[model samples]
Target chain A: MVQIPKTPGPSSPAPRPVPTSADVARLAGVSRATVSYVLNNTTSVRISEPTRRRVHEAAKELGYVPHAAARSLRAGHSRLVLMPAPDFPVGPLYSRFISELQWALGRLDYTVVQFGSVGLHGDEAVRAWAELRPVAVLVPGAGLGPQGVEVLKGSGARAVVTLGSEPVDGAHALLMDHEAVGHCAGSHLHDRGRRRIGVVVPREHGLESFSLPRLKGVRDALHGTTATLTELPLAYAEDSAARLAASWRDLDLDAVFAYNDEYAMLLMRALQDEGVRVPEEVAVIGADDLMLGRLLRPRLSTVHIELPSGRDLAELVDRAVRDPAAAPETHKVLGATVIHRDSS
Target chain B: MVQIPKTPGPSSPAPRPVPTSADVARLAGVSRATVSYVLNNTTSVRISEPTRRRVHEAAKELGYVPHAAARSLRAGHSRLVLMPAPDFPVGPLYSRFISELQWALGRLDYTVVQFGSVGLHGDEAVRAWAELRPVAVLVPGAGLGPQGVEVLKGSGARAVVTLGSEPVDGAHALLMDHEAVGHCAGSHLHDRGRRRIGVVVPREHGLESFSLPRLKGVRDALHGTTATLTELPLAYAEDSAARLAASWRDLDLDAVFAYNDEYAMLLMRALQDEGVRVPEEVAVIGADDLMLGRLLRPRLSTVHIELPSGRDLAELVDRAVRDPAAAPETHKVLGATVIHRDSS
Candidate 1:
């Protein structure tokens, strides 16, 4: 048994030193290159089964793990596929998709980093992200423009995929098409003989990308009809929702399309408190059919969005990064279907 | 005026890289070290005002952004403080706290990296974490043990703080004391003349740390009292909650202390749909007084827990890293108070 060193002096705590390939090599009675070859699973290395077993055992015993950044530096690129921070209030659908994406990336041996570029508005955010040297970046908002795309490309980012309504110049596009989500809700509400629709827009920063397009779709759907779109800017605060619900009669809206299930739930509860009967006084519709919505009394009607699987997206990013020169492609990653419930 | 190179060839898209400190130094007629010192704001540097201004101007003109990882490597520690993945069914309260912490950390010049260690059980998770060599690690769950603590300590992680109900053996403990959250809810229900109280225990894998302790606290609160305790193992899935709510009369529960606001919202909505009157038929209470709870009709009563601000925690970590021998202190980071609302 190899005896590890004792604890350090009282004055100074011993630094936990990571075991290198050399350390593993010494323990396995093999060369450093052999240890690296085995750990990295290099196909060219033709080693005996016993040797491979010895190397594996030594690594496990020594608690030797590969340094991700160091490996990335050596490889001239990282397997890290960074996703720009979700600029808006993320619902369960987005959360689950992100979680799944992380899992998928893990399976593909890529670390997924969520870079919160909140203060970074416009091209500056792209430039800052590029400096990180991520192989691929997935922007989930519309703030990224042509200059931003160029900045990312200039910094060794082989692939930049934007999940938004419009395609970013010089980058692969994964069109989420928020307009479609809005259209699904708008058309459904209109079909149910509801006019004078009130679309709730969040009064928070960074959500404009989603809200603007959705509002546009609502307007587009109501072009020929007598239905007029009213933009109700609502804060996430409970007091704000309560105030709005208290004056619900003054608005005289037949139906309201909340941004998502969260806002819908928020508004619905407030309306109930103010003695406003749902579906009778005001029909309510929301997007992202969250489970909590179904649990509500007179269940929340919603636009169920089926997002492209994160595993598939991760695989696509990997392929794109591996071969950047291969034809740039656009894919529709979000599909919306209206779920009729008691509320609408 | 410096002429920017047009975009590079297909094979090498980033030919003319952004100017480095050396280039900045050349432009400013100063040394590279001086440029670094000026940019980093090192007090030890003795540069005149004019020289500093010149260096700054040169850097600004050339768009010379400092490399984060290089600076970290040179300093022998990363600015990153890794937060271990929270258990599944991470509610809005935790989500908001994390978002706030990230914002606060950014303001303090610390980059927050969240490592999702879900499905990565025990020491393996710790090993996975050590790969990044974060200066500090904040474990938000109870799964990590003494061996895991040792692994982090051994890997140059200066401060290892565990935020959970119990004190972790070798690490600094930020005791959330989740049992107190349960007791707070139970005691409130008891005050409301609730004799038969049921507490929800989520059947999901990672939530055992939180759910079990909460159950114990509820049971402990009712000892020798007229109040009787019942354990309800409920999954986060809607079907499970709906099924449980449908057979409400069979359980004969007067009140329930759902683990958190998220679960409370889930179950309350389900119970309401099953024609159960809230606060009359089943007085429900939840922990983590989320904003949405207040928005609910007959607003959900909750145990509002004030966690130690992330800024304070971040400061503690920085201090601990600087002085490891500073007698390890366990901080009570989480405290519970019942926020009386319409639900109970």
Candidate 2:
């Protein structure tokens, strides 16, 4: 048949239609099942090497990428690991930890998709996550409840890891153990003969999940000691630090655990501005052992935290996914130690 | 016919089947079309209020949520905004900005999914993102090329917004103007009678994209000035900072503009440890007006960047998605001004 060429129109170009697996299958002269198997690299059924090569060539020529959603539906699973968004002021330490986790998950060929769970809560949040049908869900903070975990399991998530104070039923736990961090700080301060210790609790909304536990641990550690525990409600603002600095003499705190390195730096600068001598008048210690902390004139003391390497957590997720029938396990992933510096 | 009651037998619990829209349709005594319309709140088709109520009740009773992937396939588009992961050490200011962006997107009824793109590059990264079939892709940093954007568009991405130094062809640009930031700092220091200046270049992997442009800007601003520019290679490590600090006197730089507030604070602390007086021996300035900067002893001088509000970016994304045929536009989303504090 002879085809007649038509003149070009003056209209805008229409969006090109996305090629489907069926089109690839038709081009390769094979069944759609064969296309899916070859594209997804499913090895359950045997196929000739030539057939696979033909299918692949057809897909490449047509620029056909197997729809992730369609493939997920057919396989009853997906390569998505849904991590609930950390809706808080994530410090450098936590940020580094998360990047490492994503890298580790990537090595295992799982796409770590951070689900924006900002306004979503409770079962509603779970239902939203479930709709995406992620193979695994990592719910950080106290975002997911037991019922939510059950919903995720019912929605076909083989692995549900919750990072918080404790594990909810039906989900593996990566307990942060914030209390231990505070206890470590409290005991260290007490050992250094510091009485009247002040602990900074940042007046931020979401950080309370991490801060409150640390405060409790400090209180627990200072129970039988001569050190008097004082709760310092501090906002991460310059004016707030200035105001706290103005009343520093009235509070008369001998030592302070300023939450983390960032807060400690802020408060330390404020105190120094008020002409207070480091360690001589007030000893300051923070957590996270940031590089900047060591650069301070009176090198800032810090609680160095030891978190389970990203590889360990990623491996755990893989194991749980591979063996779904096994009982969900809880692992304490955070350990804390005090690094003495000139400031303390 | 005789009706007989069945007796319960002891057996292990089987995997619970997920409720589908078909189950809801069956229980509601309506067609699957009616169920889909009611559940998705589709406006085209008219359904009776009572019928809609019945469909909703059935869905609620069965604990069914519409599969997001399936719904996207049926609707020919998805409400997903895929943002390439920022693998660099993101400062608190940038972190907060990203969180704001996610929150704003959520407000506009869009789910912002952060795609981890650490190891992936070029066409492979685009293919990975396109497989999810997101309606829009927000390429942060220097992640996407012109060809990559074309690949994404071919894979059905309706809008591609790139945040970087320059706009890629066929993609909307949220130009960060890193060069302007550097120029602002260099000029500010030049005006302060500093004859020589040191600009810290972070030795991090991913940050070069931002740092290099800023360095170029510094060079451009000081092109005809008597001021000489020195590149200070610094890493986000204590040993590196200390090593640089030891050589600070030998460098003989009158002023230093560290990359950002975090790095400036680190370098300033190091200089202080080595008995270098701020603003006397060396003046320092950083970017991003962090609150901690104000609390510093000789407070940190900084370049205050005005990034486009998240709501504005989100609205732009929505507008672009709604009107895809419009010529791709470029928006200068970041502006910079030097905030002269005590350090400078």
Candidate 3:
């Protein structure tokens, strides 16, 4: 391939001119209001079918699209569905769900906007979100409360959906029982004849909502049996995992249920580096059965979490928005199953 | 241990009332407009210091925050920097960059919104983005052209930044220089006395912009050497990597650049499963040096990329927005370095 010579000038010659709605209206032999009505699809404006067709064709030729902010201002709400910002590095499970959610929302003619509501909690975050007058708000965190929900509703947010371990009052809840995932992992290890199990709890700020509940579930599952539970605080950092694995003998754990596959892979590799045999010395189990985990040496054993499809959730949100008085519904959004592999 | 009976009643009592802007305004003995001006720091609205302080105190007592969407609409642009949606199952490199970008934009009072612009390419995507009237738009894909840039600019977008191998004519380009990344990996393998290298190109949709350019860079660097370049199409899927690794001997490649560490790890584990010796027989290198790469047995060598801080870019966009006539500036925001380890 020939290398293109670097140009010895400014980035571009000049900015290109943009055609306006007025230009399209003029081309279609209609008023600017007619063009706006056709483009914005305002049901209030009655225009002839031929005029609408002409305006649309003219818009296509001129490449004229309605301005979003202007349209939003007129409608008093945006077609944007604001989601709670991810506070931690998203893993495959959350990433895939988010991607699917965006696709689903896009299909519903709603733009998905992810906002990091880390520092702003409860009502402060809700008020901030409400200002956008988003048609819908999907809060993945439990930071939002009943008051927050009311604030969002007052601001014209038609639907409020919260995805967490518990339900929120007055909001559609997509409960992802973290305890069930932990119970699945602990039971799987116990059934495999491993009595001493270590459950990794992420020592990160945002993950507490998930890790804490999961730890409780593990303890609950090991209640009557001789199986023991050990809590291991693991960070996402490699050095942290390495330090933890280097002194694994001191911990005296036979099998470990790493919080998720990402952390599981990290700890497993760290253990291998320290000359510890996996599955033999210490069976490793993880959540979120990612493809990469299976590609590892002594393929990673994981709890496969099947999350509710974004299409289903999106349809529900649309339905809820259309009928705000509809009774709030709760659904189990995440269900886990153990995928047995070489590691466990 | 006792099982907590699942309560059929409400999980928690209704939350206390949240203070609104009107409440703050009333408490401060000021108009709602003045409260908005003081809270949002609108330059056009002149308020006395005493009144501003009173308003601030009232808002603090009430825990009121100015609505983001309302403030944005009144200001004629949302303090939102929209980025093209991320392809899910994102590796550490992109994840780190996104996190950094969000933090940076937050510092500049701009909420970073990740919009999935999939299936919506070029001007169509730009039009969709323009509807939000984001102060700036950052397209991370190669599909955005001059027309797309112009559409954003026409819709009052103050700064349009495109991150890719090639620069868009009307937008300020932050060139990633993928060729350099590829060259760095290829030359390092060559220096290690390996020839007949195969570069793994991801068949994933969003990655083509980076992977294709990296392949060209590898070919360009190996022009005058005995090292012949082999193109290997690899998907992120496990079965795909396994299929490619199953016929590894026929390919006869000594060293392979597996695009990024995620893919490198995938192929490395697959090759090892098929009894191929790494480095000793087939040296392996991946881009986007991640912590997990070093934890692998024999470790994985990788190319590390330093992205321009999101804070710095946010500041630049803010500056550009303040002065729309400021001459557009192109920035080389991506820097690369090789991290040597056991695999290569």
Question: Could you say which candidate leads in DockQ?
Answer: 3
Sorted by TM-score (best first), the order is 2, 3, 1
lDDT string, candidate 2, A276-332, tens digits: 889899999999988768777688999998877777788888877876656768777
Compose the digit string of candidate 1's lDDT tens values, residues B1-344.
11112222345343345466798999999999999899999998688999999999998777676665566656767766777667565666677667776676667666666775545678877877877767788888778888887777666677888888788777877877778888888889999999999999988877888888888888878878989998888888888888999888999999999998888988888898789999889999988888778877778899988877756766677767777655455777677899999999
Q: Give the poorly placed runs of model 2, Cα more than 4 Å off.
A: A1-12, A44-50, B1-14
* DockQ of candidate 3 relative to the true structure: 0.29
The residue-by-residue lDDT of candidate 3 on B153-234, one tens digit each, is 7766778877777888767777878888999999998999999999999988768878988999889889999889999999
For candidate 3, the TM-score is: 0.88
Q: What value of lDDT does candidate 1 attain over all alpha carbons?
A: 0.79
Error of 2 at A86 (Å): 1.3
Instruction: Give each prediction's DockQ, rounded to 2 decimals.
Output: 0.22, 0.27, 0.29
Candidate 2 local Cα displacement, residue B250, angstroms: 3.4
Flag clash pairs in model 1. A16-B154
TM-score of each: 0.87, 0.93, 0.88
How much is A99 displaced in model 3, in angstroms? 1.2
Highest lDDT against the true fold, candidate: 2
Arranged by lDDT, best first: 2, 3, 1
Residue B99 shift from truth in candidate 2, angstroms: 1.5
